[model samples]
Target: MDVLPDRAARAEFPVGERQLIMKKLIINHDRLKEARDAFARFHFPVVGGVADSGSISLVMGDSRTGKTFGAKSYLGGFPQRPGERGMIYPALLVEMPASGGYRAILENLADAMSIAHTLRMNNSVLTNNILRGLEFHEVELLIFDEVQDVCDIKNPRLASDFKRLMRKILNLEKASIVCIGLPETYGLLSSDKQLVGRGGLQYAFLHPYSWDSDEERKSFRLLCDQFDEGMPFLNKSSLGATATAERLHWVSQGIIGLLKNFLFIAGSLAINDGSIHVDTTHLAQAYDWIKPPQTSFNPFRDDWSKKPDTVVTTAPLTTHDPFAKRKRSAHAQ
Candidate 1:
């Protein structure tokens, strides 16, 4: 990622500077760091020409909570290197197709590994090619983003087929698998005893920060401070101030992606007006542009703190372990 120009150089910059700055910024917030650590733990190093059995790890989170971002960031750490045969990829990250069929899944994997294949190729051949490509590229970790598409299938037959394909991949022990999706993706492991048994069914979660918890509030404030420092402006924006942080949390719902976007617009507005720093006035205008017209609440308003409905809190989405009872039963046996 490109670093922004020095603060002194950024002063009195043109209106388009916001685009240049925001495009290059990539913040590794706390939750994203946790997700990366989980990926690292799942990857096992080979020894004495032998590797441990491939395991499956699930990374579940709400939309825009940085699940995909974190996965890609982990992939970025393992750049493709020149191998005796060709380029070796230590890790691969591919998205689950909306259709979520076995063939689509294989095609997506092939595309990511840069393996050539025709649309007419049979499933068996394609599967073999993908597995071979995984070995050929020496991939140690395979990440599947939007995995809920396959896990949430309504048709039992489709679901069974997908699970069967996954079991085969795990059996090969070519690479550890990481599935990234909504919390509902837990169903994939709960429904399949074989998968759970094979991988121990490890789980990781990414969640938006909340203002209620003191720890979470402090973390959110620190994130705001980091973003404030990252923004290329002549003067500090004081984004981490108590009042400002609360307003930012309100508008972005503590999601980093949303926060970055909201701030980008606000920063652009400030730049356009030749302001030295982003202010509430610019934030107010940016919110109007990004939010729906029917939204009555504006956190940037003077009386925002006094408004009755100024803060709206919603519980984070969570998954209950469907296998808890089964595990207890097995232990009793």
Candidate 2:
């Protein structure tokens, strides 16, 4: 694909309309599609009375590399439907609990499947309930996001127990398992001789684009082009132009999630200011808005040839705390 396309007419839309457009935009690049395809390869229809061994696939990447987004996008394609027994979910993606353990994993699974269980229920009972749910739902694919937590367990016994549970689930052949997490998650199946020997483990790595090679640079630019085309603005952003692409790459470090956020903010700034298309100034202000005040190196304003010493960092957007905080009485002191 061409790195740059011809500019189009300007969009004349209200600020709210423009913001809504940006919110609904979904850009699917080559790498994201490849990850989705890998998931599809492992998913198979359930054949009655046949015990088909479930395959395990790993999708590993650093944070903000679109690992979870890609997996969830693929899962979204297969909507749940009414089946003879119950609701059949063709694919289900569950997040791994922050406090990782056998029971935590089971609880997360139960929550995803909407299976009710009490604190009094033991692990065996929970596992049985989960298995029954999987069978009744006829879920063909199971995805565990943030799976690195499961691999980070320090206790060997706990890890072994988790692995055994996974094996039990796979032996049932109700669904194929896809573990999505940081790169270290590859170790989840590396030491398991039975899983490895079965030749059912597959690995896919999602990485941010690096400007170290000609091919990599071209690919990154092409991705920029795709994102530019996907934007809702009527006028082309020329994001793939040499100067703009360099600035974008420097700002986002070629992470699609960051790039998407950056562009949305920049585009919003442009639309809010009654501008036809995004400019470097809008991007500069957007950078200031999204990042910490101490982050002074604005890629939009700086020379793209001279990369910054530090990477751009985003500030936390919300102050709301989900966990309970300890409170002290006024008279305690």
Candidate 3:
């Protein structure tokens, strides 16, 4: 496999500044791979033996649990082996804007299809162009990431506009739509009766493994083992060790995003400090860099014999409306 040159490397940066861009991590664990496969196998239903008609499939998870990765994998899986199929685009992924509305969504779709003149056109014209472009490009799956952004807007009509847009796309194009976001995204989709009726499948990525369940703990340990194997330090740190794993779970509060950040910080700190091993001390420094809420409980304290109180309170991942105050004020009058 030929490794592509980093585009960032070509850009001019100060000597020391370039080092910060080089340390990037892409974790390809088994679980993520499985989700990708399942997403790929998803077939649009043939109603009354007619093909090309599809439904919406949603992939939901807490923040940073690989929702985008899974969607990207499915979108990137087209033509299977390279050159087998010529210019076949099986999936198209678009991100919903932070203050999403009908026009913004149409513009995004038009941009993804590489259709110009969309900016000058009206909504009806743009819709036709998008439909034509999707058909021309042979797009079977359409994905909208950060879909919760629509719901986060102060304008209640924005959500309904998105729902209407999605329903129209499904009816006209007969292509399946895959929306990826947090639990709130599911709520947004489920609110629409028409969207839910058309075979809406909810695939949720759960929170980090919990000690409350033996199966979840075992699964988490397996994940830790994979990370341990991948750790580049010369000294092998048994991340899967009972005590170490527990500490990690507590500090990370079972979120994969935090866990990844924790490891990255730990590795960078260890390398900078001239340490060949990544131990509790390195992780403690990593926590400081990460700024997780629990600063008092350092996992790598000198008292190695006892476990520290590192329990973290979990919070919902939804972004609230910025104009919520204005709406409340209006209602008060």
lDDT of 1 by residue, 1-333 (tens): 566677778664664665677655788679889888777766643333433457888898876788888888888888999999998998889898877477788889899989998978888898889888888999877888887776665756656766777777788887788888888888865678988887788888888888877798899998998888888788889999988998888777788877888899898788778788899899888877755444466668757545444333221332233112110010010
**TM-score of predicted model 1?**
0.86
List clash counts for every candidate, in order: 0, 0, 0
List, residue by residue over 177-283, the lDDT tens digit for candidate 3.
87877877777778777888776564555344566566767776767765665555555578888777766776565656667767767766765675655777888
Best by lDDT: 1
TM-score of each: 0.86, 0.81, 0.78
Candidate order (TM-score):
1, 2, 3
Better of 2 and 3 by lDDT: 2
lDDT of 2 by residue, 1-333 (tens): 112223342255556755766666666676788778767665642333332347677888767788887887887788898888777877889887767577988998888878998999999999999988988888777888877666665666766776777777787877778888777777766778766554357788888787667787788889888777755566677888877886777666677877888889898887777776787789889877765455566667765545445553442211122222322111110
Please, what's the RMSD in Å of model 2?
9.1
Q: Give the TM-score of candidate 2.
A: 0.81
Candidate 3, poorest ten consecutive residues by summed lDDT: 324-333
